[model samples]
Target: MTSAQNIVVFEHDKHYFTEEQKRLKLDEVLENYYGDYSPFFKLIRNGVKFNQYVGVLKVGNTTIEVLPKADGNDKDTWRQLLIDMIKTVWGFEIKVSSSADLKLKSNSILDLYFELYTKELEYLLHRGLIKRYNKKEGNLYALKGALQFSKHLSQNLVHHERFYVKYSNYDVNHKIHCILYKALKLINKTNNKPDLNSRIGALLLNFPEMGDIKITESTFDNIVYDRKNHHYEKALQIARLLLLNYYPDVSQGRNNVLALMFDMNRLWEQFVYVVLKRELRVTDFKVKSQVSKEFWRSEAGTKSRMKPDIVLESRNNTIVLDTKWKNLYDNGPSSEDLRQMYAYHHYYKATKTALIYPGEEGKMIKGKYSPIEGNANASDNTCGIAFISTHTDIVIWKKNIISFIKENFFHVIEEG
Candidate 1:
């Protein structure tokens, strides 16, 4: 009997050509040798031999064969064709090996062939025959491996972290290292600041699945310990999430200017949700999607249609708030954003209108305005407008927002 292993190897080695090349070679062979055999004959023919074997000359290996073209009838025909083609073209000598007997029957040669090819490709990638372009450059700078030319398969299984650890020591780039360091920091935040050893192990163990690449625990651990990997952008995103979730308070007040910006936006929303529920005595507060139609309309349409981020309504008073992510302390509202907010107040018929922005260093704005009180109409005064700025630090911003709402809107609700 023919052993399954030998059959698989034979099939794999046969169809070594890529899909495009295989198609071209088969077309040429059919036109030249078999004269494009009749559909019936084409279907039945097992495999064709290529006129020339380019790989064999370069590699100096014999036993490569290019099988005749198949009409797609039997499965074995395709496998046999590939094996024959590889032998003829690449000239790699291959001897069929069997455990029990030299000649046994197998169920499906195509399946066996695919299995063998998967294993081979995986081995090549792991052995660095197919490697990342440069660990420091991340995915942007990847180059094709030698084997890549032979097989035009994409290196989708490659991850930035894996590439860094594998090739970091060979060449060190400072900028790339900083990125990798930040990425590790974010991952650590995700894992509750576990030791470096533990974090590295987790990353390796989480290898994305590919054709047949198996990740062992030890392999993962070794990659982590290797210490050369660096990827910055990925680290920054992860760190951002960690800062938002784990240490919201610390992130809000961090000396890092960007950190302040991020914290302010998050806390501003949170405070709005809390105050609307607690002070306004309303429980139905919800996070509105930023992609509302009103938000995207042209300036004129948006001024007429935009919904405020927060809407609080009672028997006598209705309050609408538009949250601004910009620095409100240093720079006041753009005429455009403020005008839009005013429109929301008017259109919604709300008694109170506020444009909220991130407060700057030692500056906070809390006051009411009425276009009617000046030369504007009394209707505009009925819709009081205010500009409120809250600190960028998450904890402080949250407190300031709540306090501002209480002093402004809550008092009105009580007085009424």
Candidate 2:
């Protein structure tokens, strides 16, 4: 298989291509995707502009990886940050090495997942593939196990040498192996990294060839694990991500696409929630993400709910927070965002509401919501903006965020 051409860009960055044909090829993929779902990019005059979604998109042999960039950081920094965030949010245990022998420089997010899957496979192979007793039905040269008399008689009457039997065979050729093997084929075709390809080839050689099984949502749900075979959990999780997201272009060869993208906004929200939940685990204050309350209902029972990105509740007080992935330099929060915060404060009965964003420095901007009747008195309901420096070391980033939250919303957290 031909190697893919890797291209890297930051979120909201416009990539202009010199080749007209290449741009057209990507356009075709984007057009088809937009028809069925939301388009990830907009077609410009010469190229495309990526939106807030960041991850890998492979169109034909060209792979485009969009990395999240904030506070004027380089691609590698953001790439690593994105990987860490994904690991925390998705609950994936990924091992990334910077050793001289490996020389994995500036690897894309997809490569990280690909490496994870391969590593899981290697571990399983080392432990030996698990064998499961499968009920198999086929023709055998001799009578074995239970004979399928109906099938044996219909086909074997002319050919007396053949005996059809239904037997239980204990082997690796089962659902788990089938899923892993299928994912191996997909990675071999989709991955462009030279180091990973050789590993995949070696794995396929050692792995038993199993017949293809049609995969569906229930395919994974039907799987059961015991102490003996529970190690397959990690590999199957990666397989689910790869196999379920694989899209083939039957009309054109080598034009298939695999998109492993995540919405930056939702990702930021989840990252904040996960990190806060980690930081506040020992504290009395409880951190929850997307806490919903019914807002409106129609006569037919159609209802709309309001969900705040993060909510910190203590025994006596509640603090509501919303996270924005983008920068808010000199501009203030949008009226819409402020309005949403107002609703969260009012509905949640929160003592405070704040918007958390990634920033170059720790800063706070405090504002108050107007009274319901627009009276002269100032409203007690307040919304503040807290900026956590993204340039800080990733090790201390979580603590820095938690500290900033506690300092800004000191009453609700520290005093409550």
Candidate 3:
């Protein structure tokens, strides 16, 4: 087996391979994964171009980390930035010790998540695995709950010492454990780090073995959570993320792929919304994300809706904000984005609307909409192009964003 290779590519960047690198067949594996699962990357002539989606992908022995870079930061900085953004946006709490080896040696975003899952499982194992009552059908020496007459007659006819019985066996084998076990097995297959693999192996050994299960979209649909098993919530969430995104090569089992990707556009929008909501928590104004309003309806009762990324509403005014994750260095907003803001102003009755993007210093532009052709009155609504610098720490960036919003929309809170 060849040694594992770790490659890092920035967002929207293309990577062409050397002759030695081409033999890894990562392109073929990515193409297969794209066909079978998500089309996150575009396959060019001997290379792959990552789009707005940024995350980690593992194909056999190679780990590719696609990171988003808005400013002139290195891949490692952007990698940590992406991790921090995801942890903040998705509410993932990494509970490992400060000096843990996994924390020190996590090179990829996937490794961070894997380490989180492992630590979560470690905590659960320390607390003690919970036992649940499960319906099991097996050949038991003594009849317990119910007896299957047809199967018992056919099977027990030859061996009179056993009985085919169906009973409630209260043990550690349950759906939650099954999902965790499946995730552990997947990690064991996908991970190559020795330290993390050792922890995963220990977790697998300590955790009770569970029956193999076919995980589908509806696998966790019916899960009920309460105080008794409330601790498993975090572990199960990470497990779901691991188990669902994995696409196994059923044909040869050689190119098993696991992709953990998130759209940068959606992530940027959510990050802005969450930060705004958190900043405005103690204020009179309330922040909402994807505030939808039906703009059109068809004859067949089909409806079309318009959603603005962030909406700040008080008793008097509303401000709509749309976040774009691209850099707009000395450039103007697109006509499509401007039209979308115009629609938001008309529909949401927003007094002010703006398009937010990652930018250099002093890149804010302000403009007003012209009145209708025949109308004598000019519209009072206004739109803005605001940019937040990403070269600083996230905490400073968040504070600057909130300051810019409150300063520009000061009238809303003042009037309230």
Best by TM-score: 3
CA lDDT scores, all candidates in order: 0.37, 0.81, 0.81
What are the per-residue Cα lDDT tens digits for candidate 1 across 233-324? Answer: 22333333323322211432211111101132433454455544543344333223232334345757644345467776656666677765
Q: Rank the candidates by TM-score, best first.
A: 3, 2, 1
lDDT of 2: 0.81
- TM-score for candidate 3, residues paired by index: 0.92
Model 2 pairs whose backbones collide:
none
Give me candidate 2's TM-score against the actual structure: 0.87
Once fitted onto the true fold, the runs of candidate 3 whose alpha carbons sit more than 4 angstroms away are 35-38, 93-104, 158-162, 376-378
C-alpha TM-scores of all predictions: 0.32, 0.87, 0.92
